[model samples]
Each structure stands twice: as structure tokens, then as C-alpha cells.
Target: MNDRLTAAQASRSTAVKATLDYPVIDTDVHVNDYTPALEEYVQQYGGGELVDALRKVLGSRFNTRSNGKDWYQQTLAERRYNRTLRSPWWARVTRNTLDLATYTLPALLAERLAEQGADYSVLFPNDVLAPLGAGRHRQALHRAINHYHADQYSKYSDRLTPVAGIPLHTPEEGIEELEFAVKTLGLKVINIAGGVKRPIPSVADKYPAADHPEVAKYAHYTDFYGIDSEYDYDPFWAKVVELGVPVTTHYGSQGWTGRHSISNYMYNHIGHFADGSQAFAKALFFGGVTRRFPGLRVALLEGGADWGAHVFTHLLDRWDKRNREAVHNYNPANADLELLENLFQRYGKDLIKDRTLDKSTLLLDSLGVSALPHSRDPNEDEIDDFALAGIESPEDIKTRWVDSFYFGSESDDRTVASAFNAKLNPLNAKINAIWSSDIGHWDVPDLTEPLAESWDLVEQGVITAADFKALVFDNPYRFYTEANPQFFKGTAIEQKLSSSHTK
Candidate 1:
């Protein structure tokens, strides 16, 4: 055994696992991409044209080439003109070469996961762009990538299971790949991009991004399937439900709105996964995807548990203040115009000194409820925002948000406490927080420390021993089983659970 692997076996994480009666499942271990092998597989399956397309992956958070020039090659003038958002550089572990090699080689990873105190791991490929990027050749590339993963890692399936990536730029493409990946490939877990970038109508009309890529980047919006999407996507969701695989996303919002930092990668990087997942998850809630499909089991990964807990509490709070009945409290048509005029007249003088009160429009604008005078009443279908969600009470919010959605969290995020805090969360429901030890990435310098650090939460009184069990085991098991009850069958986790039950 390598020195590092030996040391890892003797680490505290393994010690912590020794104390546990249940198995430890690491849901989000990443496999660093060996691009040359991937390229070879693409060349074989997709041919040279698609292989060349795969080679042009810009190595950004997603896989779009910036027209011609790479980011570093750009002159300041070009950067200012094109406005390229910062991308990740030097993202993998280097000094600990063996640890890096362990994840890259499935056999080594399978051998070492026990040292990391994990009984089984679901491997998300480090290169997500090929399976989730937009292009003519993407469907072929996605197939080639998933095929390569299935071929390369099947032997290690006893301990290490690689997740298949399904591109959802269109419902047709998503359904095609989903059928192929699950039915043909026999892959269980699936990773999906949270959203797809679509060109704005006016911007694309004049400067079509197909002709000018800059126009697409600068003038675009994301379509997160569940809300404001061009496609209904119910068929894709239904197919997922029919197949019984859990949905996992490692989506990043690197260049979106406030995160578009032209100078610093860190500014664009932090909380990006959380932000992207938040938008996608929130879209599912408000767009009524969860309400419509009660069997859907969605997990938003890498973003911490704190964000999930916050979203759950906030959902209940919003429902409390903005549900169908409560929203009418501030309806403009119901406003007491006489009382407002009296109060403004009494407290006014300075405010009214500037505008004429004869202008009821200007007076009402100053009073802060000025979108009205009946430009048009909303259609009956659009009356209540929460109508689609079917949220009659906070319990419904708990069922939809808390029960259906799972948050993929790292070990050291202090906010695991918030996810477990039933006292603070509305309706005393614990937000599902699953441990996804992003071991191969830069954040976790040591491979074996994640499980140990999670145990530290119990020692620090951040959560109970029961909460730690839920974080590392129960919640993740439930998430994996919610859609497909047979998700863990024949796997190492199933054997471990069966052994515990038999004992």
C-alpha cells in the first residue's frame, strides 16, 4: 500500500466509522477526468468531427469555447469587449499525487474508500460540460462520455459507482439520453445540469449567437426546465420517474448576474453551486414540478445544507405572508385612497410641494402602490402564485420542500446544524442534508478528513449523534431509495444494511 493510503486507513474518519453501527455512504465523490481517455472514447463512438468538438471544450465551469480565443490568451481590450467571466484554474489536488491518482483510478478509489470511512461512493465525473453543454455534437459527446464511464468503472461497481450525465438542453435530448443511459447502460444515478442558457429574443434576432457567440453570452437567460422553460419537460421528468433513478445536479452559476466577476475566480466561484441549485430548486417549487410529480427525488449537490434549510424556512415564511388570501392585504385596488390622501395631506407639504395633487397618478406613486388603476386583471389561471404548488398550509410546504428535496452537503459546513434543527425549522421538519464528500476536489485537501470532520459536529454539539447518522447515512439512503426502492440492492450498502438488520 502507498504511504498516504496506509495513513488514511489509520485516520480518524475510519475510526469514527468503526464506532458506527450503520454503513457510511459518500454520495458525491468526484472522479478527476483523464481527458485523453475520454477523447479516445469519443473518437471511437462519435468520430473525428464530434471528437474535435469535444476537444474545443473551453475548460470553464461549462463547456463553451469563447468564439476563438481562450480566456488567458485574451488581451485586456478583448476581455473588456467580450466580458468573459473568470473560470476555475488549478482546480485539482497536485502535491498529494497518490490521493489524486486514487480517485482517477476506479480500482484505487474502491480500495481507498474504506480508509475514508465510506462503504460506497457515487462518482460524479469532474468534467460535467460534455454531458451538459450545448452544441450540435453534444448528444453524441454525452453518449460517448457516459459509455466510457460505464466501460471504465463497471468492475469497481462493488464499491465505486459512477453517475451517468444526461444533457437537458432540450426535452428530446434529455429523454433520448435518459433512455439510453438507464435502460441500455444499466447506470443507476444520473447527474443533470440545473439549467440551460437560451438566447434573448431581441438580442438574438439582430445579432444571432449562432453567427456571433458574444451576443449569446451577453444576451441570454437560463431555462431551468421547471419554470419559464420553452419546453414542458414533463415527459423527461415522467421518464425519470418511470425509470426510478434519483436526480442529482452539481450546477454552477459562475457567470450569472451578480456572480459575473471579470477579475477574480473566487468571487465567481463561492456560493455559485448553492445559487444555481437554489434557482433550480425554487423553480421546481414555484413552477409546481414537485406538486405535479410527487415521486420525484431531487438532490442539489456541493452547495451546503445551510442554503437548503434557509430555502425551506423561507418557503414557509413566504407562504405565510404571500399565500392567496394573505396577498390581498396589500392589493392596490383595496387601498384606502381617502385615508392615504388624508395622511399624505397631513404629513405632506414638503412631499406635495414638488408635485401637483391633481395628478392622482403621481400621488399614488408616492404612496407606493402604483402599478394599478386596472391596466388589466390577471387571467384566472395566473391569480395565485402559490396556486400551482397546492400549498394550503405550512405542512404542505414541509411535504413538498422538505420531504421531496435533498441537499448535498460537505462535512465541515457548520450549517449542518441548521438542516437538523427541527426546533427552528417550520413544522419541526428537518431539511434532508446528505453528505457528499467532494474528496477529489481542491477544497478537501485530505481524502480521509471529511467523515472525521462530520463526526466533529457531534462532539462540538453542533448536532446530535443521531443527526450525524442521518447526515452520513439515513438521509442519503432515503434519497437514493425514494424514487427507486431497489437503488441500493446488490450494492455494498445493501449488504451492510442487511448485515446490521440481521445482527
Candidate 2:
């Protein structure tokens, strides 16, 4: 029965692939690292003590119960007592044991690519991602994990490629790891955290985290790399563009704001990645990263594409109402005080008959002086908030938003239609939505299910044939190749990419 089920799954996806002339590039396929082997490398870098510490503090590197102390180990009462955010359990596929093996074994994954209907896949490595949460030992652990993945997956470069995790807590730190991961280790792709959680200035000034860990955890803000960061991250971004790599982030916003439900994991999980992606996108757009580096390509993964389109459309809507010229429509200085008073006298016979109210109070209220006596309006230079974004027209927003960013929509996300809806998007622009088969995770369950699932969108006429091709192939191709022309150099899809005029 299991054999039949597996065959049926593969056949469906394979049939979907047969309809496409272009090769499908699964941009966000996940893979796990063998924990025991990964820990050996971690020990090599941070020693036995580090391994023992991680085991006690984080459980084990890839263990489902690992990473956090509160949720899994704690009783329901204890979880409630601490307000601990629920952690994920059974994140990997175990019932489909072959699919489970395929994630850890790169060679096996490469061999099974045809069944999954992907010619090539960019692997998001669980081990490469493991080190970033190791705190003080992260820099060393990152080196350990990167080296491990390079050793394990380099041989399977033809079909499967793993992304090296670069922690950008600081720009210098990120550049150092990127240098090793790409230049030294020859890893082609990289994934970065969407934002860094930093201590709020007022809170950190009074209560140091070491002195007050519980107090400090909540007293923090996320510094989305492009905006309001303590240190300028331009050096890191410059290095990224200079290195010919696209900025891809798989960050999520769990335990952030409303996502901190203590018992239900799904409560914390739903739309968290989208929230993180939106935060990152807003920062990049408003902070002038897109304006400064027009060629920079950023892919926000697993959030789906609708949010990007929503942001784009809203930017146009906001700019229309609040551009440099339109904003003056609400200026208090432009209000006719005499006309207002005459109208008030005409309309306020009974309302103001008994009152001897000062007319200047009305003027003060109209000028907004009565409400905000403390903080005045911003400087002339600061009046235009969109100045940093350099959005002079809708075209500018389209260029900056569409050309600079790609959204990763997983197979089952119906909201992906927003990406291809040219009429709905601002300036008739279609967002660049890449196909991401989030296999090996709990959401996918079966490795062969994604391509067929995505194909169903096309069958239902939710998106056209060309739109489906763009989602599955062209967008992913452009996302990688435009960032680095040689991104697919030695891979199976390299020839197909070079031969096509798809970009």
C-alpha cells in the first residue's frame, strides 16, 4: 500500500513536469544534516565542552526537542507559568521514511530529484542553520556546519546545492563567513536571517541582559538589516552584490508580538514567515537599500508572494495620498481661519450661544498645537518620508519593488495568485514569485507532492500556463542567474538556463 502511494505521488508530479518544456527549479527545498556527524565537526571547532553544553542547553543539534528549553520539556502548567512560546514537534517526515532519508543523504536526494519533478534544487540545510542559535559559539559553529555541508553535499552539486547560513548580527561577521562559505568552501548559495533581535536602548541602558535575562528578552526590537541598524550594513550588502550572490532569507517571527501563544504551535507558526518577510521588505524599501543598490536581488522565502504584491500596491496608494505635493492638502497653514470662523458662527447657534470660548483655541486645534504641544513637525528635509526610497512616481516603486525582490511561494499557498495578477498589482506589475517545494518539513509530508500541488493552480485556471512556468522556472532562473550569471554553471539546469531567452 505504501509502495502504491509513493508511486501515485511521484507519477502525479512527474506528469505535471512532463507538460512543462522548461525545467522546474525548486528554490527552497530543505535538507537535514546527520546530527552525530555534524556535532563531531562542532566539537572540532568548539571542543567537547561545547558539544556537551549544546546537548544540555539545546538538547541536540537537529533534535525536534532541541533549540529551546521551555516548550517541549515543560509541562502545560509550567509552560503557562513561564509564558513559553510553543516549539515545533515532528517537523520532519518520518512516516514516509524514504523521504526522511532523502533529506539527510544528498546523494539520495539528488537521485530522487526526478520523482519530485525538480531538475535542480537549492537546498536549505538544517545543519547550516543550526549554528546561528548557538549564541557565543555561533561563529565557530557556523564554520563547523559550513565545512560539514561543503564536505557532504559538494559531490551532489549536479542536482542538489545547499545554502550556507550567514549570520548577520554584524556586517563584518557576515562578510567573514560569506568569504569562507563561497570563496574558500565553494558553496554557491547563501541564506541570511531577516532581522536581528537587539536590545532596546532605554531598556538595555538600565537593565543588562546578563543581569536580567527575562526582563531583557521582551525589552528588545528587531533590526531588519536594511534600516535603523546600530551599525551600517552597506558593507555587508556591498560584499554580497560584489560576490555575485542573491540575498535569500528564511527568517520567521515566532515569539514576536502576537505569535507568542504558549500552547498551540500553529498559533505561533501561521503567517510568521510572512510577518518577518514584510518587516525585512519594508526596511529594505524605506531604508534606500533598493534605491542605492538597484541590481541587488533579495528573495524572501516561504512567506508566499501575496504580501510582496500587497506592499507594492499599498506603496502606490500611500504615495498617491501623501506624496510631496498631495501631502500639502492637509497642511494647517493652508486653512482659511476667517472662513472657518464664519462657517462655525453660521452652524453653531445653539452649540456656542452660552459659551465665551477663546477663538484662538480653535486656531490652535486646527494647527494641531493643542494636541501635540511638545513635539513639533519635522524639518523641511524630513517632511518627505519617501525621500529615502526615492519613489518619485509609481514606476519607481515598480522598478524598486519588482526588480529588486522575489517572493518564494510554497506549493499549497493559494495566495500566490496575487503575484501573477498584473491588474491588481501597482503599475500593472507582476511580482516575481518563485516556486519553493518546502519538502522534508512537516508541511509537505510527501516529497513528490509539491510540483503536482502547484500544477493544480494552473489546472483550475487560477494562473495561466505562462504564469505557472514563471513561478516554477523562469523566476527562479532569473533570481539566481541575474544575481550571479554563473549560478548554474556546473549544474544539470545550467545548459537549459543558458539556452533559453526566459530572462
lDDT of 2: 0.83
How close to the true structure is residue 292 of candidate 2, measured as C-alpha lDDT?
Answer: 92
TM-score of each: 0.92, 0.93
Over the stretch 1-503, how does candidate 2's per-residue lDDT look in tens digits? 23323444556799888777788999998888787987897788779977865555355542323225645687777777777767666788888888888888887888788898999999887556666677887777778778888888888888877888898889999999999989988887789888888889898889998898777867888889876778898888888888998878887888787988887889989999999999998899989999998878999999999999988888899999998888877666667878878877888667678876456666674456554464666567867768888989989989888899999999988899999998988777999999998898999998888999998988888888899999998999999988899888888897665666565
Candidate 2: clashing residue pairs, number: 0
**Which runs of model 2 end up more than 4 angstroms from their true locations?**
1-10, 53-69, 72-77, 364-374, 497-503
Q: What digit string (tens of lDDT, one per residue) describes model 1 on residues 288-348? A: 8898889999999999988988988888788788887888776666667787778877898
